[model samples]
Structure formats: structure tokens, C-alpha cells
Target: MSNLSATSTAQNSSTPIVLTIAGSDSGGGAGIQADIKAISATGGYACSVITVITAQNTLGVSAIFPIPLEHIEKQLDAVFSDLNVVAVKVGMLADCDIIKLVAAKIRQYRPAFLVVDPVMIATSGDLLLKAYSISTLKSELLPLADLITPNLPEAAELISSDVPTNKEGMEKMIGKLRKLKFNALLLKGGHLIDDENSNDLLILPNHVEQLNAIRINTLNTHGTGCTLSSAIASYLAQGNDLLRAVQLGKDYISQAIAHADELDVGQGHGPVNHFFVGHANVR
Candidate 1:
């Protein structure tokens, strides 16, 4: 990697800086909260520019208020002007204006790595992104992403097709998504009802890699996607290639899920234990 690329690699300095643009989950299970926890746990310094604030808990999201575009712009300016941000993770842009604004600034900065998580709906069946902004998200934001992480429902909605239930259907759906021109795509299969293992497909221009894990049975899965995507960005900022970053990220999330029951945070669906091993315990 060039010196420019190495500028934000955290291990080179005290820590590599990774920025997350997403909503704020007051419940602390997902959104910017989950992003920060996952990035820090995976060895990156995390910064955030929040797009919206939701009145929510593990049960569901009740209300959402978007941050003004100007404030959002200011947050980006403050961070990029000083921090050598190596990678970025984007999630839950609530409206067309916010989506466009985020896209514009990210385009300007041109960070070394960008992970876009198409977070349309919450785990509790609440819609996070505005229905009208779906088009803007697809046209303005997705193409600029280095990697786009979309679950089965999101992939189906993105292409206006039925949800892929099997591995063969997933490959076909990934082909349709590839035409959108992202550098790579990770089509997550955790939502597959019949699968004993959570199998995710990573599709690059010339290669395809399958990452599978024994499905952890737990109700504490509220922030799995956010954690996974941020973990990938953290690894990428640490100078790992796309495939290696993704591989490491999957392992991190799996461990988090396995240990999620340890955190007694919420009454309904809880959060994964991002800091599965605290610093004092690290040997």
C-alpha cells in the first residue's frame, strides 16, 4: 500500500481512524452505537456523523427525527478536515436529502475504503429509511460504495425481485446486483430460514468467496449487520484486502453472537457483545 493508504492504518499510529455515518440508536444496540463498538473492538478508532436519532429500544423504533443537512455537513467537515480517515461505513440515511448529502461529502473525501450497509428495515419490523428515498439511495449512494452489504430482503428490494431462498438463487441475485458497479458485494444469508449455517456470499469482479458459520441461536441479534459491516471497515483500515477483511469480520461477528447472552441490556432482542474480550483480558 502507498503511504497515502497507510495514513489511516491504526496499527501504524496509536489507532487507525474509521468513520461511520448512520443514525443514533438510543437503545445502544444498533446504528452508530453498534458501529462504534464493533470498530473499536476490531482495532480501529471510530468517529461518527449521525444522520438521525430514533426513539427506540429492543422492542421497536417509535419515532425518528433526521439531523439537519447543514449539521450533518458540518460533522463531516470537522472529521475529514483533521482525521486521516482510512475507511467509512454508511447506514440508515433516513431521507432523500440526507442520502444525497452523505453521498456528496463521501465522494469529495474519497476515503480508501467504504462499506455501505443497505439498512432498510429494523430487526423489529420497523422501517428505518424513508420509502421515497430508496431510489436516491440506489442511484446516488450505492455506486460509490467499495462494498455494499445487503441482506436477503434488502437485495430483493434493491432489484425489485423476490427474496432468494437458496444458494443458487442468491448467486443469481448477486449477478443482478453486480451490474450496479460496486467494487464488491456481500450478500448476507443469515436471514435464510432453513439454513443450519449462516452462509454469506462475497462477490468480486473476478472471484466469489463463501463465508459460512454455524448459526448461533439467540434473540440478541439486533445489530448483527451493523457490527459485521463496521468490523469489515475496521479490518480494511488495518490494511487487509477486501476478502481478508470480510473473513475476519465474519469471525468477529460470530464470536460476538456466541457471547451476546452475557450482556443483559434489553428486554426484547439485545445486542451482541462487541467487546467479547476486554482489553485487560487480552494476552
Candidate 2:
């Protein structure tokens, strides 16, 4: 573990500092790149620690290279020691070692809020996480997260169950999800293709709130999860309550998806317009 100490000067800054620990997407659509965009767009100063470097685009991920453990520790130390990171959004830990390392650092630095996006499979059907790392993510990292945003398939993978197909099936898995040791779980339902609306469930210890948004028909839905989680972290860093932050994040993502077709980035599965000017009040 790195022995770097945090500076006290960060507290004096006006802008909220949000840190993202994730992989770097060469596509500039997801992972660290998308996270930075979301945080910056949502009124936060963004910093990042890249976990993996992937040869990826809107089409698919062709290759991945996990950062070395020592280098990861250095990156963690470098950011934590300087920035007053009020919130952290974590994504794409490629293996068990990386998961444990991040968990340890989080315990040490103790950011005010932690948002974990359990990234597994890419939109292009490529596997980002190694099969053996799933257990480590469940046991080591997820528990430390203030919020875990897992899409339908990722949720099923966490609970070791089959993916749910409909609203009823989604509701049925709440019990199973509750068994996990997390502060809150946001079960994203965008994967429910047959439904006309994209709905998500925010499950806390005492309550479950349904977040609804009309599904926008578009192929440019890439990086939706990463964008959403980062936006929520930004809002939380800005001192919004949990529910309010989630609502704001939902709105931001909805508008981004609705305006996704405006951009001409990739041939397949283009990215949402992170800089879409319509939602200027989202901050």
C-alpha cells in the first residue's frame, strides 16, 4: 500500500472534486472518458485513475490491458493525496487483485461517497471482467460502495441467478438482491428490451423507489451505465441527498439518450451526447 498523505488545501476550493477509478476507453465513449465528461458536465471537478486500457470503440472491445498493481497504487496515492475527492465512482476492475487493492485504498482514504458500477460485459458482448474476479467484486468491493449500479445482467451475475425478462421477474429478484452487503442497489432495467419504458429500482434497506424514463429508441446508447453512475456521484458531491441525486442523474441520462442521435461518432452503438446543450439546468 502507498503511504501518501492527503493535503488539507483541497477543502478550500469552491468546486467539488470527484474521482473516477476505471478503465480507459480509447473510444472516448465509456469508462474513464465518459465518467470525466459526466462529472464535469454535472458541476464537479473530475480526476481519474485508470485501471485498464482497452482497445475499444463503439463497435466492440478488441483487447484489454490491466494496469500493474504498483502503478495502480501510485495512481490512487497521487489523486487522494492532492484532491479533496468528495465522491468516488469505481468501474472495471479486471481481476481479483485489482478489486482488493481498490477496496483497501477506499478504506484508507474514506471518500465521503462511493459509487460502484459493477461493469462486466460490454454493450458489444465483450467480457471486461475476468470470470474469477466476480467473487472478489461481490465480497471485497461492493460492500464498501455507498451505491452499486448494476444492470439486469450484472445483478443476475451478482446473485448467481438467471436474468429476469420482465417487470414481475425484476421485482421477484429484490429479495435475492437484498441479501448482498451493500448500502444501496440501483437495478437498471434498460436491458428489458420489450418494455416501452426504461425503469430502474433503487433498493435501500427500508425502501425501494422506482425511477422511470420513457425508453428512447436509439443505437447510441453506449456508456449509459458509466454516465449515469458518474452523474449521480457528481450530484452527491454537490451535497444533494441520495434520492435527489439519483433523480437528477436519471434525468441527465434520459436527456442524453434522447439527444444521442444528434452526434455522429461511430457506425454502431454510438455514444450519447454528453455535451448535449438541452439539459443546461441539470447541474
Candidate 3:
């Protein structure tokens, strides 16, 4: 009975709970699988609502099957009823119906933080969302997000213009997104032809932060974006500020990339080692 009492107390005061409404990656590289790993690795409890499933590996995505809209809500309702979600991250909203359902749920539950990682294309040039869903995602889903982490390609599509490749042009692009009324814009600078390390520029309403990440020279970078955003969600769920969360997330991913630089997972590309051993402090 005493042990049960302790367990109940802990349950009542759950440290941090983050939810990921995303697709499932059977390879455990990206999607809901990566989301869970990233959250747990950063000291947060993960609750997931899978919107789709993909038969995928490091080489490429073989097939994708989106889950029904009703089932998506069922999963969300189940989690919301039981857990107090502090932060939510969304990825791979394959269709507009599912996106709308998710947006409504976000409004209803109103988590403290929400991060949207628009999974438009796969690592190996696969289209994830439908063409019709693009407009819906912009007008309906993105504005509600506390932060939107978009790469060079995604930022281009968001504003329907060419994304400037250089720093000056990139900052200008980030400026345009700032006027969109989002809490934060983490514009990833991965596509620019630069040196070894990558520069990610983050623009906010008042402040601007720059993250300098050492781009690991390896094929194992399949789930990087998913992992980064999930780590941010994990930190936010624990009551960290957006800027702090972003920094911590960058650090976490940098370490993950460094640890997995040599491990080979598939024929073409690979994944980061989320559970790398011998780390003294995680999160």
C-alpha cells in the first residue's frame, strides 16, 4: 500500500509530458518512432497519436498508408483524457482532413507549447503531404504553432518564392516569416553550400538566435529534423523557454549526430544513434 501511494503521488506530479501526433517509421529512424526516442532521451514522457504509417528504412520510404481521420481523433482523445500534455509536436500530416482534426484538438486542449515540423518531403525526395493539404496546412495548422521548424526547401514553399541561399537573403526570408504572427521561426540552413558546420537562423518577435551545428559528414542523417523538433518539444514540455529549448535541442542533436557518425544502418542513408551510451547528462 505504501509503494502504491508513492506511485500515485508520482503519477499525479508527472515530470513532463509531450505529445507527438505523427506518422510511424518502421525503421525507427523518423516519424513517431524518432519522436518518442527524442522525447524520452530528453527527460520527458511521450504520448503519441499516429496519423500514418510508412514502410521505410535509411535507403528510402517504400510505401505510405495514412490512418483514417476518426482514428486520429481517437488516439488524441485517449491521450488527452489520461495525460496532462505540456507540449505537442506534429509531423507528417499526410492529408488536410487529418490536419484539420489535429488543429481542432490543439485548440481544444491548448497545450503550453506546440511545434510543427511540416514533413513535406522525405529524406530521399518523397512527397509526404497531398497537394491540396498545402494550402490548408498554411492557413489552418501552421499559425497555431508556437514554433515552425522549416528547412530551406520548406521555407521556399511556405511563402511560394525562392529561398535566398546566403545569410543576408536567409535573414530577409526569416523576416518575412516573422510577420506571420508565429511565436518563433526556426529556419534551418541545411541546403546552403557552406563549410563543415551548418547554420540555423531563428527569428522571433523581438530576439534573434543563431545555432551553429557541426554537420556530421556521414550518411546517417535520416531522422535529423524529426529528432530536433521532438527534442525542442521535450524541453518545452518541461517548462523551458522557447529559446532555451531550441538551444538544448540543437545540442542534443549535435551530440546524437556525432555519436552515430560511423554506424551504418542501410544501403544509402542512415539514422542517428539516439541511445548512444556513456553520456553523463542527457536533456
Candidate 4:
């Protein structure tokens, strides 16, 4: 690896200086922690503003600490006034006010890539966002997005109904989601299991591509969604195509899951290997 100076890094910063405004996961498996790791792993400088803090582990989320609206704005102000942010990845926007606040800031500083991960539910079946925030995200946020990455359940919540389990059903759901006005939609299929592989669909303007990966067999698959979205954001910052970024992001998550170790923190599910530790970037 070449040594990178802060000045040279800042001056010759890669194509994107990615930003993620999301909640914090204390376990460091997901949320802001995973975002930074994913961004760096994809070779981008990550700037983050936390929307809320979750006292969470592999077992479950215990408490939620929401930052004040003004504090969230202040964090954005500090970053926007100084650093040059290239792409924005939104994770858990906890409330309606946060959705509106982030939407306004994003419009003011329209970055090259705006990826929205409408984090309504986690893999552990936790309700991360409120009902009204859904409206705020659709009305005030989706219009400003370059890409919207929604998992199966999120797709259902976004369209206000059930998402189809098969390819045909996915097409119908993607159609409903496209009405929200995003340039692209990466409908993740982690929750959808047809046979064995976890298939994700990327719906762009002229075409749709299937991103297929063998599902790593492990219960230590927490934070996979957040990791994928942030990894894509980081790649976008580094000037990768949207489809390529998503593809690379999927590969990264697969590796993380395959190499996931027993952190032994929680009893139910385990966290992914974001650090990738002895694990190669096999994807």
C-alpha cells in the first residue's frame, strides 16, 4: 500500500469524499461504524454525521438515543463548510424531522452520488424508523437521491405492501419504487431466498441486472445491508459506476460474512467481519 499524506490525500482526494448521515451502532458491527469501514475499504475518505445512537448488539437493540435536530444540522454544517463531500449515503434517519433536515442539506449541496438506504427494519426484525419518517423520506428525500438501496422489507414499507419473493414479484415492486423519482434503484434481495444464492437486482434507466452471490452460510451476517450501501457509497466516491459499485459492495459483504468470527458479544446473531482481519477481499 502506498503511503498517503493527509495533505496529498486531501488535495488529490479520490473522486468522492463520501458522507453518511446515519445512526450509531455501539457494537461497531453496523451503522456509522460499518459505513466508515466500508468507505475506507473501498478506498474513499468517509465523513459522517450521526442521526441517532442505538445501544445495540448482535442480540438486539436495547435503547435509541436520537441527536437533537440542530445537532444533526450542526454536524452537517461543519462538514459541508469545510470538506468537499463527493457522495452522500443515508442510513437510519430516525424521525420525520431528520428526514427533512437531511433532505434540505442534500439539496443545498447536491453531491455526485446520493444513495438512500431507507433503513426501516434491520435483519433482526427491529423497527428502526417511525411511520411518519417514511413519508418524509418519500416526499422530501427520494427526489434528491441518485440511487435508493432498499432491502425486501424496506421495499415493502416504501411501497406500502408486500414485496414479491420471485423475480416477477421483484419487477412489480421495483416498478412501484421507481415512482419515487430516483435515478436508480438497487433492490437488495438478502431477505428473498429463492433457492440458495442471495440475488440482488439493480434497476437502472435502460436495463436491470441481477447481482448473484452464493449466500455465505452463517448467522454472523449482521450489518450486511449497511456494509453494502456504504461500500457502494465509497466506490462511487472513488468514481466507480453505480452497478460496479453495488457489485463490488455485494462481494465485500460476502467476504465479511464468510470470515465473520465469534465476537462472543451477543447470544442470538453475530456481527460481520468489517475489519476483514486475516480474511482476504476474496470478492
Q: For candidate 1, list the clashing residue pairs, or say none.
A: 10-15, 10-16
Could you arrange the candidates by TM-score from highest to lowest? 2, 1, 3, 4
Report the Cα lDDT for residue 277, model 2.
Answer: 93
**Quick one: best lDDT, which candidate?**
2
Candidate 4 local lDDT, 70-169, one digit each (tens): 9999999999889888778999989988899998998787666788888988778899999877878889888787778898889899889886777678
RMSD of each predicted structure: 2.7, 3.8, 5.5, 4.9
Report the lDDT tens digits of candidate 2 across residue range 1-283.
1111222323445888999999999999999999999998888899999999999999999999999999999999999998888889999989999999999999999888889999998988898999899999999998888899999989998999999999999999999999999988899999999999999999999999999999999999899999999999888877777788899999999998999999999888999898899574464
User: Once superposed on the true structure, which residue ranges of model 3 sit more than 4 Å away at CA?
Assistant: 1-12, 278-280
Give the CA lDDT, 0 to 100, for residue 216 in model 4. 72
Error of 4 at 163 (Å): 3.8
Best by TM-score: 2
Candidate 2 or 1, higher lDDT: 2
Pitting candidate 1 against candidate 4, the one with the higher TM-score is 1
Global fold similarity of model 3 (TM-score): 0.91
For candidate 1, give the lDDT. 0.87
- State the lDDT at 120 in candidate 2: 98
Provide the global lDDT of candidate 3 against the true structure.
0.81
Q: What would the per-residue lDDT of candidate 3 be over residues 182-231, giving only the tens digit for each residue? A: 66789988667565667898877788889998776766788888999999
